[model samples]
Target chain A: MKFIHTGDWHLGKLVHGIYMTEDQRYLLNQFIEVVAEEQPDAVVIAGDLYDRSVPPTDAVELLDEILFKINVELNIPVVAIAGNHDSAERLSFGSSWYRHNHFYLTGKLIYDFRPVQIKGVNFHLVPYAEPGHVRHLLDDSSVHSHQDAMKAVIGKMEQNLNPNEPNILVGHAFVLGGETCESERTLSVGGSGCVSSDLFAPFSYTALGHLHSPDAIRHDKIKYSGSLMKYSFSEAKQRKTISIIEMNENGSFEIRERTLTPRQDMRELEGHLEELLDPKFYEKQKTDDYLKVTLLDDGSLIDPIGKLRKIYPHVLHLERKIESVDQKQLRNFSSIKEEKKSELDLFEQFYREMTTAEFTDEKRELMAGIVNKVLKEEAQK
Target chain B: MKFIHTGDWHLGKLVHGIYMTEDQRYLLNQFIEVVAEEQPDAVVIAGDLYDRSVPPTDAVELLDEILFKINVELNIPVVAIAGNHDSAERLSFGSSWYRHNHFYLTGKLIYDFRPVQIKGVNFHLVPYAEPGHVRHLLDDSSVHSHQDAMKAVIGKMEQNLNPNEPNILVGHAFVLGGETCESERTLSVGGSGCVSSDLFAPFSYTALGHLHSPDAIRHDKIKYSGSLMKYSFSEAKQRKTISIIEMNENGSFEIRERTLTPRQDMRELEGHLEELLDPKFYEKQKTDDYLKVTLLDDGSLIDPIGKLRKIYPHVLHLERKIESVDQKQLRNFSSIKEEKKSELDLFEQFYREMTTAEFTDEKRELMAGIVNKVLKEEAQK
Candidate 1:
């Protein structure tokens, strides 16, 4: 049995205040061509079909059109699941009837885990869920983290599995020890998001999402097809690809990589403004690609972005070379369990972000009173 | 072909700042029983399955459950369409596959309107669409108002119809001369939202929604199944019922109404606070029903709402008898093309509503600047 494994399309993504709909459309159009050429028995989109619960209208239309092309036009079966980014209830609409056409889309969790069997292969779809929600659903108090949640869910699923036949687990979670990029870097802010890969030992393979890098995890049996495109500059060097997996009756599989290039590649260019703008240098580069230009000059030039945009039409970002280190430091500070800051501390930070007004004792005291009242209500709840 | 024709469920409705999910659930549970006992050949939900686009999760679950019961469990064909309140794209998810089970859900309007043929009946499902959307779709510039849109849609549909066969047009629109309650009265505030009943003259029956009263139109062949419940205080005198239509092969039909009493009826009580609170007055009334008390006393009373709530746990509204005329005046004034007020006038009214501060000349000048800028943008668009 053979299938294409892909996920984390994030169809309605917006990066650095730029709508990525056109970028996503460019890549997915090519993806459909690949699917048509390969003509796999089935297509497995692990999770994260959308970037957010309430996607834009165009994103909804794009998803509908692409799914119709795959499942109806090409007559290939598609199995999709809702990731944490999706509204499970919205995705599961018309699901009861969808199975008749070999279009399996699972969103919400069910206690009785059943594999969608196609051609003797069992595909267990465990969509991304909060650990607390999973614990309540399963009536298990011991589930405290992503690892514990996945363990309990797979444990019950194991009872209904046939070890003799090949089984695949389609999931969306940060696996332990996986590499991360700046965009998805926030998922493991406190490093509690990842689940251990060892839990899927019973399955022939585990196809996953949420991690933007394809090589986030290195095990041959566990794969991250990676996001459809480079979501951030940190992923500029990463190769975006979908995986084509071939599994035999013996439960052994071989994997091949299929790379899809973005129409406008994301790149970072650092140089002195004068040298960077030289006709010789400008003529040699792919100026149309989305670029982040870093000026090496210590003194700021007038309208650097304006000047850069003339040469590189898609210059999306501009910065002094020295400020790059400050950004990195801020990023590190943000990920240092800083979201768990005290209420007053968080409020002070928010106040600074929202206004140029100074934080005085009078305002601080007023905020403190409100914060205490909220805490009181929280305690009562 | 006998079918249950019902619509305007408004499943996730909230009235008077009170959640109506429980009330809708109570009525719908009985609705399923009616379906089971009657065992209609088909179920045609005209439109408005939900109160609004982006309904709450519970509404989604309830609609899913009810549809599952009818289409999958009871094995009856269910045909539905999107109303004005629905997001067409969201409702049409997995629609291609839903057709295999005879669950026809039409959301978005298309150029070619095809009728779903079931048991010799050709059911034309014309979902509610904006006038501009229909004009753009049909490439006919004449489609301007709700009446024109419906006329153009039905005119195109008429070309594809076989007059000898029983044809039912399932639609969601305010037909001309349809009676409406306070909840849906806003739709025709200026009386432009309604279409003429003559548009459905070609069809054997036109099952409609939007109007909350079943007898909204007097035509024998054109009838409104009405909303699922009394969504407004103005509907207190109206009996809520679901229409079951028994259509024969010869295009003749018999209609029967199945009334479902609300668990807690909505009622209005008028009297002096003291008289209303007396044991004699309280004992005769259904204290548990949702109540709106009108205090007829000339002087104000202390804690009248608190006192009334002791006997009537569900006092949703309280008003002084003298102020009732003011409310009616406001309602009348609002429906008299008030929404088309000048930008500055509308802003002044909004400002008055939001703040106790008076609208001074200085603030008026500041607002005029912003309103003019917005009007400029609107003109450009």
Candidate 2:
């Protein structure tokens, strides 16, 4: 038995108000090419299939096309789960019909760790879930933490497992041995998300999502295929890959990572404006990559984007830096009398900097009261 | 070629704020049972599979159970389309994958009118579509009205069709020779939502939706099976049915309307509150049916709903009226008002009736201006 493992597509994502739909489409095409070339027996998309609960129309269309190609055209069985970013009900819509075509999609935890048997393999699918969601689903008042809920779920899963056959677990969650990303939803507050990697020792292999690094977790049998693309600046240095796993007759498996080259790579650069503007500066960098340029200018730069984009058409971001001010220089004076200014007057000045609208007399008075209360509390602390 | 034609399910419909989910579930279960009993080559659900685009969780589950039973459990080929009530983009999702299971669902209007070949019959599916959606999909700026857009679409569809085969056109829209309920959406203002029935004459048969009455449209070939259940009071008298269509070797077709009994019946009765509650009422009316009781009381009735439901547990509506309020007396009061009350004062009184909060001075002043403007305009007319 063989299968491809991938997850966290996060289609229709935007970073700092910039739409990444085109870039996402480019990377997803590469994913399709990999699927076509590798031609695995089955595919398992862990979770976080969508970036937001209410995806745009185009995003839905794109996902439809990809799923169609993988499940129908290629005739590969695809099993997917819903993550925190998805509306479980929406994801599970038409899933019953989908099951006939060998596409198993589960969004609810109500099934309580029931394993879906696909071609004699017991696949335990646990979609990304919070402690509260699990507790509500189980209707168990004692389940206060993710670990506790997972334990209960695992217990149920154990009942259905055939110990002789190979058992594979697919989940969309943060394991203990993975680096975190800003886009990945936090499952709990403290130790709730900290699931021990050894919990799945009974399984032949574990496929995971959430962490954006393909190699974030590295147990002999457990692994993370990361995301389909680099979704965050923090993942600029990370390599994106999809895993292809082949199981032998003995229930042992061989796994290999196939690197995906995104249509537009993400790259960050820092230097003076003159050096960056120089044609030689970008000679070493990929011109087609999504660029974030940081300028170490003394003051504000003029038309920085227009100039930089001339050389790099994909320059997505620009940041300017002046000489940093000392932390002590930013502190406020303790006594208003020492500065010969009333607290109300000081509040008026602060209000002007914070808001674009002009403050009225009533608004100024309100601001003064709030500021005084906050300052008094801070002083007491 | 033999197939079942069904439409206007409104799976999660609520009539007059009374939940009919149980009734819908029962009817759909019966529908699947019929499909299994008849064992048609294929099943065509014309449109309006759901009551709303964003259906409740329970509604989704109910729909899933039925679709799964028919398409998956029974191994029947299913083809569905989107209605006016559905979001096309959402419906279109996973359609590509669905094709693998021989379930072809199309939401967008196709310019090329090619029919799907099922058992040597060409199944032409025309989903319910707005003029704007047609225009956008065709990318033809010249397309304006619903009739024009439909004409263009049909013209495109005819090009790919083989008139020799047993061609069946499936559509979900208002057409000539049809009666509609309030539940069916109006296409436009004084617009031709009604297409000429002859447009689909080239096909052996046409299965239509949108109209609620099973006999809303009658033709040798073009027919509307109507909604599965009475979705509105206007459809209370309709005998909900599905068309079982059979195509002979010569490419001609025979159609029959198979009566469908919903899990719960829908009924309306009028009488005094005491009479409705009496054991005599149960002798004639089915207590298991959904009942709309109109209490014919001369004065205000006390707890009319509580009293009526004692016998008719499904009393969905209760209203009291004095038979003495003659239409002649109503006509004497010109403009429906005999009192010399200013429209402003009337509006203020109406506003107070609708809300628990007292109208503030600012709100009262605004309402006064609006009411005065409306009255002055009426006086001018």
Candidate 3:
């Protein structure tokens, strides 16, 4: 059984206040082109089909269009699940009826543990669910974190596993040791969110989402297909690709990666403003690419962003690196200072700083009177 | 061939700032019961499934649950269309794949005019479309109004009609002579929106939505199922029902109405506040029903709405009849008085009313100076 594995489309993503729907649409069209050429037996989308719970109408339309092309037009079975960003109820709409057309879309987690069988492979789909939901569903009070929730759900699937058949697990989780990017939402506050790679030991291959890097984890069986594009500047260096897996009768598989060229590549540049914008240096580059230009100039520059934007029309971020460092230090010092002062003391410090004068006894008495009135009002409330 | 006809669910409607989702859900559940008991060959939802173009998530869920029960679980076919309030693109999502399961959902108008044939009956679906869309689709510049748009669409469907077979036309439009209520949105300005009933003369039966009354149009073959519940105070006395049609072999049909009991019926009451709330008058009424109380007492009443709400918990509107009548007349007189005056003249009249003083020439000069300055600023813009 051969299949194309992809996830984290994140349709309707807004980066730096610009809607990325057009860019996503262009790349998704290319993905359909790849599917046409490869003609895989099935397409497995791990999770995170949408960037938000209630996505804009266009996002919903785009997903609908692409899914229709693949499953209805191309006549290939599609197995998909809902991720943390998706509203399970919304995504689940029309899912039961969609199954008749070889489209398997799971939103909420179920204890039935039934796999969607396609071309002899048992594809176990585990949609993302909150710990509370998993706890109630499994009747287990110990499910307190994402890891616990995934373990409990997977444990139920394991009970009905067919050891002889080629088994594949598709999930959205923060696996232990997987590198994350700025655009990926944190599943939990601490390490408790990370699930061990060993949990997939029984499967032939475990396709994952959440971490936005193709090489997020090191395990041979556990792999991340990564996001469809560079959602953030932190992911500028990550090579985005779709994984194509070929499984043998014995449950062994060979995974191959196919790279997709984005309409506009996300990139970061560091240099003096003048040198970075010089035609001789930028003439050969992809000028229309989304850029984050960091200026290293020590002195003040007049309308730096305005000047940079003239050449790089898609410049998303512009900053003076030296000034940002100074501002960071200043922010840290002020926060520490603020932590040690009471409301009245902070007010007094602000007043003295503004006037550049010593605190007089009369001014202190007036400030005390104002503070007493505020305290009285608060107590009454 | 027999089918249950219903429309204008208006799910997620907000009447007087309260969401009517619960009441709509209760009534729709009863509608499902009727479909189950009748065992219709198919279920035809004319249009306006949602109250807004973008329905809330709960509304989407309810529509999904009910459709699933009718189509997948009950093994009945569902034919539906997009109404004026629904975004055609949003409702068209998953429609292509849904066809495999005998769920035909049409949104945007298509020129192909392909009829969905089920149980020897040909159902031609014409979803609501703007004049511009019909003009472009049919390549006819003459389509300039709702009437013209419907004429062009139905004209195309008529060409493909099989006269030997039972033909049913499902639509969402304002028929020329339909009695409309305040809750139904006007499709267009003036009389241009009214599509003549002659447009449906070719079909065996015309199932329509948009108007909120069951007996909106005086046509034997063309009928409305009415809204699921009373959506406005003007519709308080309207009887809401589901139309069940039983068609014979030669396309002749018998239409039956099934009235659904809502969780709380909407009603209007008029009397003195004291008399209306007295146990003698209220004991025999459905006190929990949604009420619009009009007070008749000619004296001052303290906290009337609050007091009425104590007895009629679902009181949605409260007004004093005499004061309202007086206010209406005053409003008309004031509007007519204000319409014939310039900005300065209106301002001077307002000043006199507030201060009970004459409009002095000095005050007029000052007001003219401000008005001129505002006009000058507007001219510059």
Candidate 2 per-residue C-alpha lDDT over A100-134 given as tens digits, one digit per residue, 9 for 90 to 100: 78889997666657787777777898887777777
Which one wins by DockQ: 2 or 3?
3
Compare candidates 1 and 3 on lDDT and give the better one.
3
Residue A94, candidate 3: C-alpha displacement in angstroms: 0.2
CA lDDT, every model vs. true structure: 0.85, 0.78, 0.88
- Local distance difference test, candidate 2: 0.78
Better of 1 and 2 by lDDT: 1
Supply DockQ values for each candidate: 0.46, 0.49, 0.54
- Rank by TM-score, descending? 1, 3, 2
| CAPRI accuracy category, model 3 | medium
What is candidate 3's CA lDDT for residue A367? 91
Q: List the residue pairs that clash in candidate 3.
A: none
Residue B53's lDDT within candidate 2 is: 75
Top candidate by DockQ:
3
Q: Each candidate's iRMS in angstroms?
A: 1.4, 2.1, 1.4
* Docking quality level of the chain pair in candidate 1: acceptable
Ranking by DockQ: 3, 2, 1
Tens-place lDDT digits, model 3, residues A126-215: 888888999999999999988788888888888989989999999999889898678988777888778888888889899898888998
TM-score of each: 0.84, 0.80, 0.84
List candidate 1 segments past 4 Å from native. Answer: A185-189, A323-381, B322-381
- Model 3 lDDT at residue A111: 68
